[model samples]
Target chain A: AQRVTQPEKLLSVFKGAPVELKCNYSYSGSPELFWYVQYSRQRLQLLLRHISRESIKGFTADLNKGETSFHLKKPFAQEEDSAMYYCALSFTYGSQGNLIFGKGTKLSVKP
Target chain B: DAMVIQNPRYQVTQFGKPVTLSCSQTLNHNVMYWYQQKSSQAPKLLFHYYDKDFNNEADTPDNFQSRRPNTSFCFLDIRSPGLGDAAMYLCATSSHRESYEQYFGPGTRLTVT
Candidate 1:
């Protein structure tokens, strides 16, 4: 079974402050992790993937296999960064190709 | 823009009434998925279509059914909606079965009275 856990349901940070959202997963096989963001009144969009190793909107996440964690972080938070973030694990084997998502974390960057 | 699209952004259906949510994609993706998300909760996978093949989650209720008439369109049909079924229905598309990135439409909000 594949499970993704997001420990924080809500995180409040002041503008220009550093922020981090925790995420953990349990899967027997190798996992492909991804971070998705949903802004207000917008559809869910892919923020970044572990494999890509790229940063978007000043946010970055690194997958740690030993710890089974993929935490998203940013040096400075902006008011526009306030949104819902979800961590997902992709089941690439057997053509399932479905994403197992975590209970999202709502980030509020107070200006 | 070439992207996934969902119809009837807001839908209201009476309890025990049947309702269908439609989705279409111009991305020419091979995989299409439907997810149900309640307030303050994660989106639950209802089912997906890999081209013409249908895959349903084990815990998905029998009252929920899906149809993919073609590669560009998919539909989620609720046989009888209940109060609990009121939520946002998200439609997503991917280029391949193993593709990591998925394109999502602005989900349809269903309200069951």
Candidate 2:
């Protein structure tokens, strides 16, 4: 079975505080992972993928094959960063059309 | 400019009513997908179209069907919507040329009475 799990349903933090949203997956084969964000009154969009390994909006995620984790982290939380974050996994590495998303985490950054 | 578009952002339909939701993408991607998201739940894949080929998820109900008459347009039709069928329907697109990115549209929220 292929599944993605986000442990936190909501993460509340003060502005300028460090934020970490955890994501884990269970799959037998190699997989591609991604982090997607949806802001208030906006559509869901790709934030970053494990393959790129680049920072977006001061956020970063790393895929650890050993632990089957692809946790998203940011040094500081901003008020604008309050939104719903989803962790997704492409079941097959080569056939990348389909995605399996986790139950998202809602981050609330207080001022 | 909006790359992927879904019309009638909010729709209300009566029980057992047939409804259709439309999606269009200007990115000219070769693949398009439809997903159903219940409150606080992950978006579940309903089906997709790679060019003209349609692929439906194994557990997707037969009441839900999709059509893609052209590369840029796709439609999801619910033959008879039940109360449980009300959800946020999202449409996404990807290209074989680019393996990692998927463009999403502002989803349509369906309300069943």
Candidate 3:
């Protein structure tokens, strides 16, 4: 069974505070991990991917194969950063077109 | 420019009534997908079309069906929507196969009355 898990349904942080959204996965084989964000009244879009190892909009996600975790992190949070973030895992095979997404975490950055 | 477009941003349908949601893409992608997302829940894959070949999820109910008449358009038909069928139907497109990056459309919120 392949599944993605985001432990926190909501995370609130003060402006300029550090923010971390945890995500974990369970899969027998190697998987591709992704983080997607959706703003209010906006469509969901890709924020970053584990393979790229790059930061997007001051956000970065590290993939730990040993722990099966791909947690998204940002050193300083901003009010505009508040949105619904989803962690997804892609199966390397067997209907590769589909991505298994977690329930998602809603982040709120207050001033 | 919107790569994907879903019409009728909000839809209301009576219980046991059939409803159709339409989606069109301008990216000329070969693969299109339909997902059902409820409030505070993850989006569940209903089905997808890869160049006219429809692939249905094992757990998808028969009430939910999809059609891709061409590469640019797709439709999701709910034969008889139930109360639980109310959700946000999302349409997504990818340029190629097995790609992690997907462009999503403004979802259609379906309300079952």
Best by DockQ: 2
Worst 10 residues of 2 chain A by lDDT: A89-98
How does each model score on lDDT? 0.92, 0.94, 0.92
The digit string of per-residue lDDT tens for model 2 on A1-111 reads 999999999999999999999999999998999999999999999999998989999999989999999999999999999999999999857674599999999999999
TM (chain A) per model = 0.95, 0.97, 0.95
Where is model 3 more than 4 Å wrong at Cα? A93-96, B97-100
Shift of residue B11 alpha carbon in model 1, Å: 0.8
* lDDT tens digits by residue: candidate 2, B12-47: 999999999999999999999999999999999999
How far residue A32's Cα lies from its native spot in candidate 1, in Å, is: 0.5
| Model 2 segments more than 4 A misplaced | none
Relative to the true structure, candidate 3 reaches a TM of 0.96
Clashing pairs in 2: none
* lDDT ranking from best candidate downward: 2, 1, 3
TM-score of each: 0.96, 0.98, 0.96
Q: What is the C-alpha RMSD of each candidate to the true structure, in Å?
A: 1.5, 0.9, 1.5
Clashing pairs for predicted structure model 1, backbone only: none
Fraction of true contacts kept, per model?
0.51, 0.67, 0.59
Query: Using TM-score as the measure, which candidate wins?
Result: 2
Query: What lDDT does candidate 1 reach at residue A46?
Result: 92
